[model samples]
Target: MNGVHAENLGARKAKATRWGTAFLVATAISVLFLVILVLSIVSQSFGYVLVISEVDTASLARNGVALESQEAPALIETLKEGLTRRHLATLEEAKPLESRNREELLSLVMMEIVQERPARTWTLVQSVFQRKAIFDFRDSDFPDGRLYFRSWLRASLLANPQSSSALDSGLRGAAIGSLATILLTLLIAFPLGVAAAIWLEEYAADNAVNRFIQLNIYNLSGVPSIIYGMLGLAVFVRYLEPLTSGVLFGAAEKGAASGRTILSASLTLALLVLPVIIINSQEALRAIPQSLRKAGLALGATKWQTIWHHVLPASADRILTGTVLAISRALGETAPLVVVGASTFLTIDPVSPFSRFTTLPIQIYQWTSRPQGEFKNLAAAAILVLLVLLLTLNATAIILRNRFSARRRTNT
Candidate 1:
């Protein structure tokens, strides 16, 4: 009997070891894939490009009057004098350069007068390995083209607005729009989600109606986000146009032609994230010991007071964890934003909740859709920015959560 038991134990130990090895292998594979994805995006964001200029800076400065040397007013006058009426009108229509500052005017002069275009682009690997080939190609195909190694992710890319020319395009408007929409989404979703979760977990009776509501909330969390977009379109955009468009507040601007504004998109994302928040909050609340609730009640505390002073503080860290997950999901959401009418190209930053907007994901999607290789590089850089934004948000939330958790521990 002892020999037979020993053989069985050996078999079980071997099986457990095999399973543990498999799990480690799976985890390693996931990490490897993530590293590859990040490397690929980084590679596309920095490299060598052959830039061809239609007008040389030397030619523009032949009269010893460089555009950069002039003040804003003089630069504006030079732009008007040097450019044809049609070209000047086009520049103004794109964005009014006259009202802009000296630095902006200088950039515009370079963009319009110099007319620099990327003649050829090389990825990081190609730029490193085929340096001679890149120079030879530029020399043969574009003798006048200058080859320069440029990092696409720069301050100008983050500061300027979107442009038809990728060289002049930036993510400032999109970044602002994204931040505004996410802010609105969090404000709308967090309190409501937490309140609903608290009620469902601590207050609501275990009746058929309550059970059905719980079931539906769980089901809704798994629903396609685009469906929420459609619902948002019908309810927020069409039905509540006056409210969402700020028409009710008498703040609707002339440019806001419809209800497809930042408010509408934010409400859509709020709805999209609500279910997840509620479900996660409920789980967090449920994890608390039942004895804590009984102790508060036994001490003659009101149910609301007990919950407010005890239960919520105990679960605040987990609640924030849920919020972080919900926000991360909302930040990367593109389908619903697209369906709800996020603009693909907007040069102006969102001035209010009622203004038209675009997000980082939408901007990346639009850039990737374009045929130009330069746009693809721009898209990669935008992806890097989006990742950084997400990390920053998550880091801030984590810090708050940890602080709350430490306080709770100290108080106990």
Candidate 2:
């Protein structure tokens, strides 16, 4: 009997070993796939640098090559006058190719020289440690030998709206518009959501009114965002256009009903995400221990005071996590913004609440759909930027959550 029992234990150990091996193999495969995906995106977006150079007309004549009319000397002179001394030096040091050989030269330069500037560096005695910068080449693919990478990135951020030309692809207007919309959305949604949640969870009796409202909140969260876009069009732009005249525009400016301004879009998004924030806050509030509430009551504290001091403070971490997540979702949304009449191009930065706006996601969408291969790369780089922002926000939330948990443990 003892021998049989030992045989069964040995079989169980063997089975566990096999499962562990399988798990490790699966993890390895998943990691390998992720690496391959990243490499593929990098190769498609950044590996190619488009080149359009003016051949040296004299040299072309000497070499019996057909002249393409453009003068290299004039272009070079203009570039030298415009660019800084260091930039000109860098351009001069970049090995040149006759116009025909530009593609090959550009490939070589990108492979060897392109690098981003790091944020920080540390030195200990004679040694230095530095964090290498990661370039979003996939987003800003400047023409080889034509413009410096840093110049191109700055141009994208600074340029005003232009036609469907690469020269016009700047983030100035869109960036400002996005900032305004998000600020408005936060202002409108945060209060409405938090208040709704507080009312539903704390004050409202468990009855039909609460049930109906709770169900509708969940339903609203699931409603297609474009529907809210339509609502904003009818309600804010048409029905309440009188009140918004001063708010949407001043004496020199004009506002339209076609969903052109930041306020309209923000209201649309506020309605879209309000349900999510409400649900999350309610859940967080519900999770707080009833014992804390009872103790507050035992101390002769009012219901509002108990809720404010004990319940909210305890659930603050979760509420913050939900807010961060909702904002992240709002940041990535493009379809509703598109439906609400976000422009594909803008040159000027939005200066006020009534002004126009564009977002990173919308910018990325515009770039990706364009025929120019460079735009596609730009879209990829923008995607990476958005991903990094989301990661940073989530990391902050995680740190806060950990700190809250630690404090709670210490208090207990």
Off by over 4 Å in 2: 1-36, 53-164, 243-259, 410-412
Best by lDDT: 1
Off by over 4 Å in 1: 67-70, 84-98
Clashing pairs in 1: none
Query: In model 1, how large is the Cα lDDT of residue 352?
Result: 96
Return the TM-score for candidate 1, rounded to 2 decimals. Answer: 0.95
lDDT of each: 0.91, 0.64
Q: Which ten residues in a row have the lowest lDDT in candidate 1?
A: 59-68
Error of 2 at 104 (Å): 28
Write one digit per residue (lDDT tens) for candidate 1, span 260-284: 9999999999999999999999988
Angstrom error at residue 26, model 2:
8.5
TM-score of each: 0.95, 0.67
